[model samples]
Target: MNEEFVLETKGKNRLIISPNQYCFIKLPSSGIKIVQLRPDGVISLGKFGCFEVNSVLNHPYGETFEIIENKQARAIYTDAFEAGNDDEDLEEENISEAEISSKLLSTDKENKSRLDNRDVNDIGSGVQKLTSVEIELLKKDSELSNKGKGIIEKLIESHTNFNKKTVHSQEKYVKRKQQKFLKVFTIEYLSASNLLRFYTSKDFGKIHELSEESLGLMISLADVRPGGRYLVVDECLGLIVYTMMERMNLQGEIVLIHENEHANLISLKYSDYSEEEIKKFVKTINWLQFFEPDNEKIKFPIKSETEISLLTAQKRSNYYRHKRNAEITNSVIDNVKRGQFDGLIMASTLYLPKLLPKIVDKIGGSRAIVCYSNNKELLNETNHVLLNDVRVINSKILETRVRPYQSIPGKLHPLMTIRSGGGYLLWGLRVIPGDKIKATGRGNKKS
Candidate 1:
């Protein structure tokens, strides 16, 4: 119903960059900026460069673009994106040992080789001859390949200790310089994982410090699918909702019950889902309305058919709009009363021990109920509460840790620095409290 929601898209290709849609640009400085492409508009990346949005509208995502001195963008292959490209560029200077050698420059490869960085004084020994203005001039030179090899070659030639440094140190130096003056950027699709990463880098606390790996694991454990109906309570700023929508892939229905008077799902705007899709799949209800629909009904002005006929065209249109909305609200309440949702997922800061009993019944028997929190103690208390409650079965706390390793050959090991905490998850299944169970676990112990 908002003007921001449009029925038609500029392009049908999801992989290709489309105009008027939100996409992320990964800058040469390792920073990301989200932008909405407008027709014939220019995209500025500050010191890196600027280009027309139409220049990349038809191109596929993940392709890198370099800014020429003329302020135009050209698609080019970067060393990071394409393997062996760095080696090929550096091979002429005879310093192309291997791109993988850079990772071991710190502390990993001294056991295997004698060429370590012990004698390398990168900070003081090597002095760069090119000034800031001269470097800018080189970036604008249209004669170069626009692949940034020219600038790097110049930098290596200008350094006094270019040959004194080992292959590892040399590569690291070039890589650092490349990140600064390449004037390059890549466009990405902005999927759920990418969205989570953007938030993690910008404001981790805003999303309760939830990691992508943990979020994916929770969704998998919940058995989210295209056709299943689901219930959710999110306090992570529509993060769970967006990820759930990604898993649902524009199918089925998700009923989100919020504790606040209005849902602040501002991040969902960049999800690229049309208004029609969101309106159809995601049904939002107030906490009170969900718990007591009769007492907190979605109210509307009552007008008889005869009374409506006496009004003008504008009043008649307004009346129908309000009538349709109220009808939809009442219908959602009626359906929720039918109960038996496929699953219930929560990522709120509320007290779970008392909250679970009230909403767990909405979830169907044998279905999953997953809760996420920044503190493990909250889930631990919930686990204790559900341990004896017959309404739930197999309640337990879960945590998924993803250890990332440095992706360089011959230096393949986990990175010393990593993300410490991604929070915890509590999992359980809905069950009939009155039902008598013959056995609860292995060995068939009767309850």
Candidate 2:
């Protein structure tokens, strides 16, 4: 494979892990943690267990590794495996009452009678005989053998009404217990979708509640791809730019317009792309420099090396700063003046009407203009403005959402709670305007 392909696949398909690359260290019951793997390292998963970084360094992404305290016991779980269930292959007759009743107590007559009379839907915590402290003790003692399998088995044995539960409910109880006690975690590559999920879960404010589906639509509508020159205004701290870069496969140039003096692409640091790769694809310019290039300042001549060697340290520093700024400013201005971009993508909190007009004209004819806003009312107002402007055509606002469902067989249903509000996208196609044409007053003449 080529260098780019190999880099992209390092944590994707192949089982090789590289140093200094970010990987998701998922935990049982707990959520995911994005960690940068270093050579000769150790990662602690808290209550689950701690592991040597080298143990998983060379493993493939998406494989689950179980942690064990004993070196010899760890031998069986060393193979990175995918966790799954054989429930689909199980027949109803295959389930035995003895296996289900292993956790129930027949000696307690009153409790047994109460469980016998209780409805299936009336399940409660009182059915489990093990207390919270007992479960914790069990967890402490079960770290060696099958990781936490012993703990789960003991908990099942202590559940008084486990046998009374329906097959589906029984499976669910086992699954929940397994998730809590299992000392296994899966490693995954840091893709754009994964990054969005990570930030959304960790800090929704960072990404402005932007979901993977909404981001996918934005990229689709904007026609983001390799070798495409696009104009972007990212208020989400380079999330849009990062998505575009991934879509472009680290190719093409993006002219990023920012309201601040420097672009705040803070989240880009978490991405797998190197500094050189990001620099190759993204170029930043403030609104002031982009809208009005200071021609006089940029026209200043650069001092030769010999002449600069004669200057003071502070003067030399200032001189170099001016030279670099002038070059960058001139480049941005030259590109803007040369021609329009392939598309325009904006994700800002600014008023769309005011912002759209300023940059919409810069978009090349037959290109797309996509704007993202969390507020529906803002996009609604922007749509009205686009309808009146002749330079834009087919203006519309779209909202996309993803509702997740439980994939379990025979018990499949929509999840009780799911992430909502992926925001809205305002889409319009940039076009060249024709000459003005007026109609004569034919009706008045006939009258």
Candidate 3:
């Protein structure tokens, strides 16, 4: 009750409230929720079964909350409330008045609000009051749509903690919950306008990494032109491909590449493009693997001849070496060739390091783009290395942060929410012979 609990994210369907202070408990997204840090082992409310908060706190996040459901427990008001409600005996057993006061702080505060105090009078009829200026700010956020801004404005109008500070706090809280729950499905072939709508809507389940916002940013940064021969590697469920197709309107085909084991290719299904159209543009390069010979030519090599020569030179009698060498050589040859790419765009963690050099080489004097996570140390190092190379020009790191507005009774505040493992973009155009520059330094005498 008096203790502080930091929320921890588990990989799956679990959120741990406090690790150091109390028992671990399984938390359903919605249920009769109960938390009692005091270690008497049970917190009880009528209809809802008891919960031991300390019992589950010790376990890691993402661990399932396992509670035995009581079948014979008679319903008080509804079965839904029964799931989260605690035993009625705890109210009976409590002795000290002060002990109960702290435990009820959050609940008591909630009860004072009109959302809790008033009975429902048609959900839609509730009036919203917010200033025009505040509404405009939310509208400009890129993360919010017209409807979303309207909702925030309504909260502000209602005067529910509507100040700037409280609004941001509420936004963060809501944003975190949205990310966790909304990112559960894949959206395919979404148009730029529609994609924006979907992101602001927050009804898509869990937003994918290649969600519309990411794609829109990609489109803007890439500066896609019709005639460019682009090399692409996207681990984000072909969301990149959809962007290229919609925006680039290419004269030349796009070469979409990936690591051999990448499962994203299996998920690529577009309503607009036929299988043949997809095949015509995409060339799959299976790393260190061979396929039965086919009549159709693959622009991307299954293995390069230079790689074969390297393997022969090494004289190591190992299958792995031969295969690995071939993949490397093919990628290298592809990257340095001018015709291989007009520009490069990649969104792969494993392929970024090895693939980027080859892409820069192949792009010759074209553009190269690489997306990475902010936590990645290698991206910074890679940018420094590329900048030092004379053939690389205009290297930059770009990041875009999103904050959405939720329509609720309280003021909108940003929750501590940002999609984990996203937010760094390394980009630049390539340089060839004519693009070279010389630098002058002051003459120095030998010391």
Q: List TM-scores for all candidates, in order.
A: 0.84, 0.83, 0.42
Instruction: Put down candidate 2 lDDT per residue, 1-447, tens digits, no spaces.
Output: 113212232122224556677877666564778888776678777776777777776666766666766421121222112132333343445332222222222232224334333455566778778889998988878767545667767876787666666545565566677677777777777777877778888887767778889899999999887778888998886888878877776556788888887898987887777686676567778777777765423786878989999999999999999888778677777777655788999888889887787788788999999998888899989888777677787888999988866765555677898876688999999977654421332222211
Clashes of each: 0, 1, 39
User: Which candidate ranks first by lDDT, i.e. highest?
Assistant: 1
Put down candidate 3 lDDT per residue, 109-195, tens digits, no spaces: 344333331343322323334455654455344222221324333443464332322323333323332222211111112343443
The collision pairs in model 2 are 15-60
What is the alpha-carbon lDDT of model 1 when measured against the actual structure? 0.74
Q: Write the number of the candidate with greater lDDT, choosing between 1 and 2.
A: 1
Ranked candidates, highest TM-score first? 1, 2, 3
lDDT value, candidate 3, whole model: 0.42
| Candidate 1 displacement at residue 392 in angstroms | 1.3
lDDT of 1 by residue, 229-280 (tens): 8888888889888888777676577888888888767678887777767777
The lDDT ranking, best first, is 1, 2, 3
Worst 10 residues of 1 by lDDT: 1-10
**Top of the candidates by TM-score:** 1
